[model samples]
Target: MGFTTPTPIQEQAIPIILSKSDLIGCAQTGTGKTAAFLLPLLHLLTEANAGTEEENPKIKALVLVPTRELAGQIDQAMEGFSYFTPVSNLAIYGGGDGAGFEREKMALTRGSDVVVATPGKMLQHLRMGYVDFSQLQFLILDEADRMLDMGFVEDIRQIISHCPKERQTLFFSATMPPKIRELAKEILVEPEEINIAISKPSEKITQAAFSVPTGLKVELIKYLLSVKSVPNCIIFCSTKKSTKDLERELNSLDIKATAMHSDLEQVDREKALLQFKSGEYTVLVATDIMARGIDIKGVALVINFEVPRDAEDYVHRIGRTARADSRGVAFTLVAPDEQRDLFKIESLIEMEIQKVAIPPEIGDSPPFDEGNRRRGGGGRGGSRGRGHNGRGGGNRGGGGGRGGRSGSGRGRKPAGNRR
Candidate 1:
């Protein structure tokens, strides 16, 4: 990890965290926010243990991420940075085997220097009465906005209550919405606040949109990919069914593609991301779960199959490309009905996205009719991707509860999760 030059967030945040000051740093994803907090946290932990003879690996830092994928990501990053040092870490998340839970229990109860976890699963462990956080020194909430959207606010409050009151709390988010500020106010006392690259897409991203009929989306994707020399792409779909359907159809057209959504088991989900990262697939069809912190490099393009519900999410979806100062393109397929979403996005970013006409190959399309356009439920409904991990009878509906199993990320109903 020869990260010599730090991004803006890292430059400003690292020192503040090192000083043990509570902080709330706001920045978009892919802006080195992880290292901004982690590097200092690691340094503090390392310095604190410099002369200690006791080596029980007590958890000194707790990072609560919004998604299981992000939890795994932070755990991997910790290992990378602490490779030459004695920094033991564990990533606790839902949707794993019983053995996995046992391992998490062992690490949480026994010891680990750092613990990265998802909010819901972390609450589950805390409820079990085995884990100890009375000595927690640093608490981090990554992707705080997403957690709030997933109905994890109450769970987060509960988890925070269990920790020592006198602790350094750091909350990092892509966008600093009012709700996020509200939470920060409640939790952080005299926190040094910093906002970098707020509510804006990177300048390197070439943004454009296609206003087409919903029916023509698949055809447009087929024609565009066939015509353009796309090295790699991510097609963001609105639904898990559509993700799977598009992947299957793209494969039928002989394009190496895969669908990644809640329908996939934890194993398969990991495998899909691995295959994509390893260059086994040129395209990854997914939902907004991939929109945030699941890093995959050399992504030349991001195609929104349908407009996202939230304006800020559009920024995140496009942020996947145009990362690390490399130029890339973001194309959104906006249905006539989704004009409102597109308008919101343009308004949020304070720039009009270039409107591109669909190719003639994908012929006549539906015209935008305001009255006929149905209001799209674009954002997370209920527990977002907290579907049960069960393959069958034991299906834990997302958010960890007993319910009829539906093979989708935002699967069928199960009132709510324990968290």
Candidate 2:
């Protein structure tokens, strides 16, 4: 992996990191951010181990992520890249059996050259008292923006408090929101900044929007999926209830579909994702938590069940497609009340989303300026308020509990740290 030509992030960030400087990498999803830091970290570890005899490993590098899926993804990539080198690694995250916890205990206590972990699960190990980072030399926050969004600020602070005072830090994020900048200022020391095509959706993704009534979204989705050869598609909803309702609706319509959200057990969620990747299921309905770090190569379509809270999120959702060096389509169903949301996205992207006419079978669309006349259906299946069903416990669920309590709150520690 290191032998391949370096991407823009790798080309720039690797050298600065090799020089032992802190760095802030701003890049979109799927732009080789993993290798940008992993290649250099592995090289450093290999150099440090050149003449030394291999002993029980002591943690030297710590990578903190926002989700278990991301932790696993990074850990798998590290194992692939470090195959030739003697460096060892482990991924510690929540959503597993007790045996999984025991295995993590063994890995953390025995030590690994590199440890990739989610904040909450990592905190559990820390509280137990054997997980030590005394020898830690590198501390990296991958997807720092998402970590912040998932309300890991206090957890991150507590984790940092356990690490060595003097260590190299690297912060990688898709966008430099003000909160991210604030976190960077607090954590980094004279860091070099690198930005590679942030906010803009991938060129390979054909973006389009359908102006349909909130009630007709299901019909529009059915029509689009039938017409387009969407071998593997993800329908992104704003809440877990919506994911469940949509999934149920699609399956009832005989569309091999599954729903993913925080409400499902970790194993089920992982299974659904795996099945979706293997083409066992034609569609997956999920919330924004899957927006980043879950990679399904050559995904043919990404349908936004509704406009996301912001343009950055839309970019992440569309990024799922147009990945693995292939072309894909991103279709958004915009209700009449979502015009301003669409406008925000258009302004951010500097282009219109090529609004498409609603299908005749779906009936009359809502007014173009229907802002609050009947702005219903905020939650899933006619339920309101951030997942009324017993599923508001995902690491990414519940905001202050109304709008975005789980994401983008000021530096407060989020609830549901049990995992």
> Candidate 2, residues 1-419: lDDT per residue as tens digits?
43558767778878977877777777777888888899998887676556554445677889999987888889888888876666778889878689989988976776677889999999999999998776777889998888988899999988987876667888888766678777777777667777674457777889888889888899888999999966889999998888899999999999999888988878888899899988999999999989997777878999999898666688789899987569999999988777777766765665667878786777876655534323532211211111111111112111111111011111111111111
True lDDT of residue 180, candidate 1: 77
Superposition TM-score, candidate 1 onto the true structure: 0.86
Q: Rate the local accuracy (lDDT) of all candidates.
A: 0.76, 0.76
Residues 9-88, candidate 1, lDDT per residue (tens digit)?
Answer: 88788887776777777777898998888889778777766644333555667899998899989988887877666666
Clashes found in each candidate (C-alpha, N, C closer than 3 A) = 8, 4
Q: Model 1: C-alpha RMSD to truth?
A: 11.7
Once superposed on the true structure, which residue ranges of model 1 sit more than 4 Å away at CA? Answer: 53-55, 365-419
lDDT of 1: 0.76
Candidate 2 global lDDT: 0.76
